[model samples]
Target: MLTSGRKGLEASARGTTVLLAALVLASCASGEPEAKIEHLCNVADASEEEALLRGILRADDYTTDINNRTSRVVEGLERNLRDIGPAKETLSTSMCAYKPTPRAGSDRARFEFGWVPRTSKDAEPLLSGGGRFDANGAFGESNYFQTRLFVRCDMPGDLAEPSKAAWLYARASYSFNIGRTDIDQAAKDRQTALAYLMARRVTDALGCENKPLEKPPVVKPAPTP
Candidate 1:
């Protein structure tokens, strides 16, 4: 009887352990999944990654770099449109002009990623909302590594309004995480990643689909002696 009681106790403990393990796993599964991101790349001759990232840094004059890039696109468009002869009047409003709309959720205090632009740069918030990244040895903080962006283009003669304006009107918001780090080399790696992303966004906003940004001029490493 004593032996039987001991065996029963052991079995019950094992069962409890399994149940607890399952619950923990289920809890994790219920939470949002983290995304995997690629590591940054650098060529032997390319500027160090930190420099690359800095290239994309928010202009000191403005807090949001993406917004500034977006504004540049808008400026170029408006400049061209102003000279487009008689088609200017048909366009209703500057598509580059955008107003901020609030996010519909209760987590406003912890996170403020949404943008209601007071100016062109304010229209879109860069890199909001946390995301998971798996970049080899790189660790990412949600606050630094996640980004969201949306650009709207109304080309005058769509189905909804078919008057006659045949120009592109666009608005865009972009966000991304630069990760958390202090090392200069590491910072460069992250910056390269951001520069690649930012360049793509700017090129797209500029309608450079067919003609992408010019490729970096290749430098043949000096002939090995």
Candidate 2:
């Protein structure tokens, strides 16, 4: 009887330890920190040369440079949104352009630029009802843009289609309807249109479609020093 009681007591102790461990694990899991998010859009088939050329073509009085313009717009939009959490993010572009000149000996040049997105690649996005949540605990909506432009330029031997450049620009702009329900629909519609227009304006000005070579998937900008 004494031995049996000891065994029973040991089993009870083991069970208590296991239960405590399980509760600790559950608490730790619940208190885990939120992860950052990575949002990306590609404007492929554009090279640095192509982007430079586009910038030259688009500049009217040399007042605003292409890189500055692109960065400004992107930063402005990003600021409009609230910070989701504390995490490093990258927002970049794969952009190219062509600039035309009337001067002899020099015809055109290409330029490119890129930036880190506000979201990080390793961000662990939050979920609601088993679905991924927006920056706010809401669903997000977005749109895309892709088109072509025609330009005359010499072809590099490595890439195909040296006679025409294909401009593929994709912008994924999203908005979450968290607080204001009354104007949610109208605001979303407006944001969508604005994103498309902004993308088109830059692409068209760059003359990205006028190149004779294909571009990579993402617009790569030279690392800022």
Candidate 2 lDDT score at position 46: 48
Write the residue-wise lDDT of candidate 1 on 32-66 in tens digits.
34332111121122344224333433221111111
Give the number of the best model, judged by TM-score: 2
The lDDT values for all models are 0.30, 0.30
Give candidate 2's error at residue 141 in angstroms.
4.1
Q: Estimate each model's TM-score.
A: 0.22, 0.23
Total clashing pairs in model 2 = 38
Worst 10 residues of 2 by lDDT: 129-138
> Which segments of model 1 are wrong by more than 4 Å?
1-72, 77-182, 209-225
Candidate 2 segments exceeding 4 Å error: 1-67, 70-178, 210-225
